[model samples]
Target: MQQSLKTAGVLAFQRSLYATDAQFYSVLPHQQEKPVWVIRHGIRGTQNVNKATEKEFSNIQITDTAKLDPTAEKMKVVFDIKFFDLANSLFACAKGKKDKEKDTVKKFRATYDAFLTRAKDSHGLKEVVLRYVRNCTNGRWLWRNLTLASTATITVVKNDETEHGLSFDAVALSRKGFTDYTADELALAELFVANLQGYATDRFRVTALLDFGMPGVQVYPSQLYTSNKPKGFARPLYAVGAEEPVRTVEDVMHFQATRKMGQAALRDDKVANAIRTIDTWYPDYESIQRPIAIEPQGVSLELQERFRIKKASAFEIIQKIDELDPDSPNGMFMIASLIRGGVYSGE
Candidate 1:
């Protein structure tokens, strides 16, 4: 595995927007540079929430270890969970593109104020378990329960450049030490992460994205199950033909994580795949003889032939969208539908 820094100091700074790329540079002080190949996870798409979750699993489980785990001991049962980037829905409605500046500001302030009030707890817990609802039985993996209230340090950014007019960065770290955690807890945590990494590598072939220092280009995750399937569990009766099925609580966690990663991959991959296709066809967007239209979503392309443009006229069609209309929808998203349905130059 390519070596990368994974110290507590580094991990703490990972969520800091102020942290520089130089701070995360992988080169060791005395070691010589070595070239290596890396597989990339596709960008998270808005539509493929399930797929996005998988990508994040691969990211945290596989890439974090192969490239970032400095301690020989695999990912500890105790790990940091950052909530800032993860909670997109909480702030999405605070500022709509069509909303006036004053209205957006008002919405943001009110929402944040209410959120802060509700979120604050004297006990320092953010999540709660109702008496009627059953919680996870295992203490080792309690952090996975999205409902548990773990102490978190939240960073709120207010600036003109930041998205949603208001932004937040929250991190919840497992304070328990390895020495204190029971053997079953540690083993279960390790097995769960390892399985996720294996699922990503085998299904999507995203070793490059999991590597350090790779380009930000997005890659698409596959929904198709790999022939080399996850073993030790039998497929449930209701989950027939499902590439991946939830056989246990651990499996459910992995399944949910994979969905989040898929959403992220879908959003990111649309543009990444589009740029790749256009670059391959025209060498660069600037070099094209014909002007190409781009929606905020991305260019149109295929998964297997991601570098190949779906149609020469896709750009022209998108250009004809009613830009003057306040309610006009932008060009179509270029990830799932484009990949599944071939494009036609003819309208």
Candidate 2:
């Protein structure tokens, strides 16, 4: 009889997909002029609700905001993505101490290899890549900004070669779910998969340009948390600029120090989360009818719920990879979780 194997004690995988901070720019319609950098502004207002003992006491609230130039008719968001080799056989590590544990680790490695092979051979990786591409083309990364724009155009250039790029109407694409794709979108998705499979010789750069058709509108950027904040101030939006003298509460807001091209930007992790919001395969997906970000246990912050529990969790599926079908939803989730990368030590 064959001996049962235990989960590996120490297992870790590095993230394969890397995204840079997305910069915001304002451009004039039907003009060839240089795009203007969106600048952050300091605004002051009075707090509506009174948390103090005195009902008449109103506190001043200072915050940061960014808006497009008055003459600008379009808002441009630009970001770069880099793909790394997705072979877990070399990047993922598994360690064991005793004889039985060593055997279990060996078996775990074998199972991972087998599953990876199946994923490559089947439609697993392609499905995941296509969903990611859909999210990018649909302007889902814009978050709140997408709703402000009446229309959007998304252009994706592979390796900075504009001639071999793809463009589409981002607003027409569905944000709630993944569905049909045009020929150009499919081509771009194929390139994404190729880079992930290590078929490309160089680390290809994929640049995403999202042009939103909203004139002189407010644009949203990721907000930075304030610690030991002033008495009356709100969280500040993320920006890149030089450190100026702390003359007021707004001066306490965070900004990246730079002499040139300083502007409000979205964090890399935020952009990555947007791109990886393809977890429609979770248990409650049928009821929710919307995709959440790919998480190990199918956690949705907005819903404040854990959809995948017990046997449905990624950690559980990973231990029994040998029994999983690479084409199934759970299998695809596991593959995506590996790509997201984290320590999965069963200790």
Candidate 3:
């Protein structure tokens, strides 16, 4: 794992009219000085909810881990319920086990209880957070990055289809899910690799937009909408592929925590701490978070690329965008799209 507390920090980027990069920067320190290679949680794109009864929550069994597409790169991976249920089962044991110690049981229950309360009562919490994502507004958009500038887009994304190909293979996850998105607003029907009938599968997630620190170039208008927005631009990106299948309650819990903590490790040391907490609280964590396979950013022809224009000097890109998409009645939007998608190959 080339990533570190410092290196992963640099690559962690978030965009929103509501959230600042600094807040994320503060959460995850940028000691490595390289763009962090991260993918958000891609939940199962289904409206159906997996309402587990109390009985199901209490019983959890081990399952197989999801594999990665060996031949694919830049492919969006999805998670399964085997992992989620594994997490929930462990926690249930920690908090509900009659054989556990009082203090240990209390602490575990407290954590789970706190999480449940927030999931069910985030509206009240938002009153205290002022401008937080409060509810799982756009759960699909979670973990997606925006194109702040057009520096490496064309360069990295357009080089070859091989780098973007999707391969289906089993991978080991340490402490996270397919993407860094997790919320209850929508019940994502994911697959359970360990299930008797499923293999490697994820869900479809929506795309998002982002900004680069290019000078004078405005990535978009002052006001933005998801429909007319660029892909990977949304803070909490949506869209996912088909889910594997749900076999148990443990799958849901592990999937949920993994999705929440994918980028979380890079977000802050605290997130790592949270992982430890859950690990201790839940012992049967091996099933959901198998051996993780995240790659670290490196110095390559792609890294050589730089933003042709900077946020401070954004005149060039912006001027070109306006020229092409004149904001006029008949002007087309492809010009801006070209600029937005154009990769800054300049070193």
Instruction: Pick the TM-score winner.
Output: 2
Residues 1-347, model 1: lDDT tens digits: 42221111100011100110001112232432221112222232233336565435332221201122231111111111111221121222233344434453454335433432332221111111110001111221122211222322221122222232211111222222112333333332332223222221111110011121223222222222336544422121111111333246765555433211111111122222222221112223344332122222234333222222433333332223222111112122221112122322211
User: Between the candidate structures 1 and 2, which one is better when assessed by lDDT?
Assistant: 2
Which candidate tops lDDT? 2
Residue 295 alpha-carbon offset, candidate 3, angstroms: 21
Candidate 3 root-mean-square deviation in Å: 28.5
For residues 1-347, what per-residue lDDT tens digits would candidate 2 score against the true structure? 43333567778888877888877777766753343343434444544664656555555555666777777767777888877767743354566453354476787787778777787756888889888888888888878877877778888877678786678788889988877877877887788888778787333333334454545677788888879988656657776665344355465566533223247778889899999999998887888998998888888888899988997888787877787787898888987888888777777
Query: How high is each candidate's TM-score?
Result: 0.18, 0.86, 0.17
Question: What stretches of model 3 exceed 4 Å from their correct place?
Answer: 1-115, 124-204, 209-347
The CA lDDT of each predicted structure is 0.22, 0.74, 0.22
Alpha carbon deviation, residue 205, candidate 2 (Å): 6.0
Ordered from best to worst TM-score, the candidate numbers read 2, 1, 3
TM-score of model 1 vs. true structure:
0.18
